[model samples]
Target: MSERHPRILVIAEAAHPEWVSVPLVGWSLAQALRDVADVHLVTQIRNRDAILRAGLVEGRDFTAIDSEALARPMWKLAETLRMGQGKGWTIVQAVSALSYPYFERLVWQRFGPEIARGDYDIVHRITPLSPTAASFLAGKCARAGVPFVLGPLNGGVPWPQGFDDIRRAEREYLAPLRAAYKLLPGRGATLHNAAAILAGSRHTGSELPASARHKVFWLPENGIDPARFNRVAAPGDGPLRACFVGRLVPYKGPDMLLEAAAPLLRDGRMVLDIVGDGPMMPGLRAQADGPGSGVTFHGWQPHEAVQDILSRAHLFAFPSIREFGGGAVLEAMALGVVPLIVDYAGPGELVDDSVGIKVPLGTREAITTRFAAELARLAKDPGALAPMAQAARDRVTQHYHWTRKAEKIARVYDWVLKGRPEPKPDL
Candidate 1:
């Protein structure tokens, strides 16, 4: 390895050069390290056009692997079946079963030999935190004498501010999986293969095995491209425009937002603009058209359009209870829109007293009550919302920029290559 620069490999299951924040993480890392080292990004490529549009220069510091080519036909059929099984199926079984294996065979196998041949200094594995893929790639890196880092290791349920509510949700969703995950072969492999682990949140960092906790590092949830989400002051005139962007899933709490808006509509307070589409779209649309609901479902818009919508929005309502990192929240914050996030996992880290309101998570009634109170307060006090919006923009500009995130990640790669420990941040 060169004394000045180190070769790095980034492996992820998601298709790169896309709108998704996961792929953007890999892309940003590659861009950051291009000047000092050889960076090869190995990821699934769903849309070649998107990859090209991303300005990825092949054979020069970056290369992409298409995971679809390595996918088994039976796997696709199984995934189709699983997706058809609805939300519960997608959450419980399909996510780990169908998606994990695809990464193992296609992503791992396709990129492993190339990584080995390159004599990489470090290997960074991105999210979903598949023990299978982590094990396979970690093994490959280990055999090649390269240090392996697995992370952002997301997928944990949100942590409610109330200890009882958080404990209850953990018992229902995470407790059962712990026993099963311990028995998986990949779990053992992951422990043995990885030299270090990175977590996006304190909650996820705590979830790491006792053996891996020593090497665990915590980074902010998401990085934002400031150009995309430019700051805009809310107009103090007509009805306020509130927007919710993301998949229309139950976990995302779209229904809860709809419910919160229902009371507001009865009093003629504001209008709700719902962007993105999924299985819950029909139900969301039904609620919008139904009496006492003031929601407008815009269906799925292009990535570029999301920025435009956020620019016009007065507030960003994110009620998700199971996010590891709130990427959309960061985008909104960068755009100078105040975020109303739940006091759970991802958004919890992003929203503070200065930036936005964080409602405590609880039973349906508790959540609804908090949302109603906060929404009403924001709607009534126009002056209060302005400072929070400015704080959000200032916070993003100072700490959450993509360039800063990439620099930190590159430092980790350097430390691993030199067989040195990560330095504790001077808080």
Candidate 2:
């Protein structure tokens, strides 16, 4: 291992920036770690061209392992079952669970010899962020004497009890069945051998075996890229511009935000910019009608455009019911747009009192009423916005930037390899 920095072999089976959101984290984290660590990313062959386009040289910065022979069959099955994206993302993950072992097996087969020969200082599994995807290579790393780090793994966020209707609409029938994953093969070994396990949310951490909780670190999976989110909101003199950026889906709760904001929007007291498209778009548009609905649907804008909208808006409103990672919330915070999020899963972990407003989970009507009241309070008190916005931006800058998260990873590496003590618990 080089004395300059720990040589990290980052394995991400699903890293592709061109795809939807989750993979972006993989790309961002792997790249950011290069800022402080000698990082060599290893991902599936599917991500090769995109990785190459991102200017990462082959063999130098990363190694693309092709496991398509095994993965494609599982992928086809998931697709055949009409479960691919949006409401179907969970089913895709279910299929991924079946195929991930093969991906890791290939990685272990390729890198096992080097790892055994002490070629790297750290072995980090940065993706399959789902905590249920137990690492097949953990035992190999343990036997080889190189420390392994799993996570920031998230998932296992239960359906909020009162939202039975929304859960049905989102087709989250398997959510209740998620507990069965804890009984999957290798989970015990994966937990026992890891030097550190970073849980992305309290829900995920609680799912860890009680004996392994000591190894758990509360590190949220979502983080902002400062360069992309450098714009500060300029909330103008007219209507209080509030924006919601995410798929227009049931779980994302865009409709809940709209229902809550309806009164404020009707009076022209607030305007909303909904920057995404999904199955919920048609229904959401129907709800956006009256004179001052003030809702502008910029259907599925590019990443740059979403940032532009966030830059001009005053507040970011998102009320996802079971969010595993609220990366969008951090993006808003990074842009100095105060976030108004549901106080439940991932967003609950990322936002604190000083940075953002949290609406306690409740029945649909109760949550909508509470959410609207918060909006009305913020609207009535314009002076409160700047401080909250500043704090939100400051929070992300200090704790939720990809580079900042990478630096934290470096600290975890130091503790694992240099015999330093674990950082204090987040509670």
Give a tens-digit lDDT track for model 2, residues 1-427.
Answer: 7569889999987788766566888888888999989999999999999989989899988999999998989988877664436565567778889988999999998999999999998899989899889898888999999999998898878888888777777666676787898798989999999999988888888889889977788888888887777788887777678999988888788888999998888887888999998988889989888444699898988787789987888899898877888888889988889889889988988888898989888878788889899889877855568888999888888888888888888888888888676675551
What lDDT would each prediction earn against the true structure? 0.68, 0.85
lDDT of 1 by residue, 217-244 (tens): 7776477876656657555565666889
Kindly give the stretch of ten consecutive residues in candidate 2 with the minimal lDDT sum: 80-89
Instruction: Provide the global lDDT of candidate 2 against the true structure.
Output: 0.85
Error of 1 at 98 (Å): 7.1
Off by over 4 Å in 1: 1-3, 32-36, 45-49, 64-75, 83-118, 127-133, 158-179, 231-233, 289-294, 419-421, 425-427
Each prediction's TM-score versus the true structure: 0.83, 0.96
Pull out the clashing pairs in model 2: none
Where does the lowest 10-residue lDDT sum fall in candidate 1?
Answer: 85-94
